[model samples]
Target: RAAATSRRLSHSQYASTTSGGPLQEAFAKGALKPGLNVVLEGRPKQPNDVEGLKQCLAEFRQQLAWVERLDVTLGQLTNVVESVSQNTTDKDAVDPENDFQREMSFYRQAQAAVLEALPRLRKLKVPTRRPDDYFAEMAKSDQQMQKIRQKLKSKQEAMEKSEKAKQLRAMRKYGKKVRRSYKRDISMTRMWSLSEELRN
Candidate 1:
């Protein structure tokens, strides 16, 4: 559950300005400088350090490459899950052993990818205030989740109401049939005419 929560946070937090605050601060404070699109550390008033920048860029580039690869891996896993869902819908379908093995392999790869990327990201020496920033992000996420839950609850209620109406109609139809089977008070022709009139 914690792993799932972290993955959700990683994805959700990616688009926010706060996502790279620590990294951004390193650059802003002259602890890390951008040298031709690469990152390097230097004295506050010093010129660009090309070699240090290249090394930092190499590490950052590798991390981004890993992230991209992980995304592709995730997409493949999603496809496999979608296929599994489709097969499960067929009453007679059975899951093969190899499919499960492949799914496990995909999950392991994704987990490994995330673990590898995290270390490289951390190596930037970026400092961040924990608990405070984290708590604020959690509050925002919770609010969004609450709104989603409310929408889902209302939709479920509507569906339940619709299903109840269908069941009531079925029960009424069955009741009429049962009564007709026991005794015939209205003639069939007149009953058909009455039903037509009611429908109109």
Candidate 2:
């Protein structure tokens, strides 16, 4: 634009300033230094300086064309960048592997929990062996028990003499079965241990 405006204005300004026309020829002869003139290196002296104007214009048009191509390339680059960014966003929103990964992580946590509880499971396990003196240790002291026949004879004598003893025996006609009917709060593991010890 600067080149075009200067080209046109130089012609008009010269025409206006040199209306007398002889001053124009004298100024040309003076060989003044050029300022802001769009000069094409060569010109046709005989026909006119018209060829110089055409050359300068052709060069300017070529430069403008190069600028237009750069703008087109920049637009294409912007579109490519936008497409890549949109694809990345879509991938982040949903993916098939995420569910599988979460399930695997949950399974891993369950496995770790089981592993951590192994020592407690071992501690809860019922013991298989009973000591050699188990029955000896379980028996009452000698004062609490004597020969079975002798004890029974004494009991029978007492029951016959004591009215209270006779009435107690009559009331207990169901015998040990009534005591067996009641439930105990003992755990299965403890029962298992007892049964194992008494297996012999």
Candidate 3:
């Protein structure tokens, strides 16, 4: 009889407290505890009352099982959300590969421009007689500067080629004598003679 009454009273309490903020607050703070009662004192229990008590206990256990399942589902959802967020952030932080490719592309363009200018540079003219005084006579415009630079580059290349040709000719002529003179490098005297001949 007591257990049956207790269940009924508990249901009534749940209904009354459903929209009560203080009741929820108290439960959260552990000021309330849920329980099932079977009897109060020595008394012959009613069969109908025992059945009612059984029903209440069954319902309470089922509600608890539902809450536990919801908790587990929520925990799994939180882990999935955290993993997705980290992957997105890491992708944003990563640098792109195209930056290196873009730099290499710029370098290739610069190299091509230099190679294409070389042939045009070779045919340009420069006066060899007044090498030091040429800059003073050249005009100070972009076109004039470019033309002068091309002429100077061509003259310098021709001079270097001519000098190399002369060296090869001299080596062919005196190479046998130079080798017979010493097993080591050419002596100081030979080097001086070579310098004077180049200067002349």
Number of clashing pairs per prediction, in order: 0, 0, 0
**Model 2 C-alpha lDDT per residue in residues 1-200, reported as the tens digit of each score:** 99999999998887877654654554566633365233344874676678898998887865454223423111123332333345545522323455654454445555555555555455656343578867645376665666666799899888787977777787786565555454343455578889999995
Index of the highest-TM-score prediction: 1
Q: Per-residue lDDT for 119-168 in model 3, tens only?
A: 44454442225576356643488898898899999999999999999999
Best-fitting candidate, scored by lDDT: 1
Q: Which 10-residue window in model 2 sums to the lowest lDDT?
A: 67-76
Report residue 6 deviation for candidate 2 (angstroms). 99
Task: List, residue by residue over 1-200, the lDDT tens digit for candidate 1.
Answer: 99999998887687455546766666566666445232544645867899999998888874455434534323234444554556465433334565774565567667766666566557754343367536344545777999999999999999999999999999999998989975665577678889999999
Q: What is the lDDT of residue 123 in candidate 3?
A: 44
Scanning candidate 3 in windows of ten residues, the lowest lDDT window is: 67-76
Off by over 4 Å in 1: 1-105, 108-136, 139-143, 184-200
Q: What is the C-alpha local distance difference test score of each model?
A: 0.66, 0.56, 0.60
Q: What is the TM-score of each candidate against the true structure?
A: 0.30, 0.15, 0.20
* Superposed model 2: Cα runs more than 4 Å off: 1-97, 126-200
- Give the per-residue Cα lDDT of candidate 3 at 52: 85
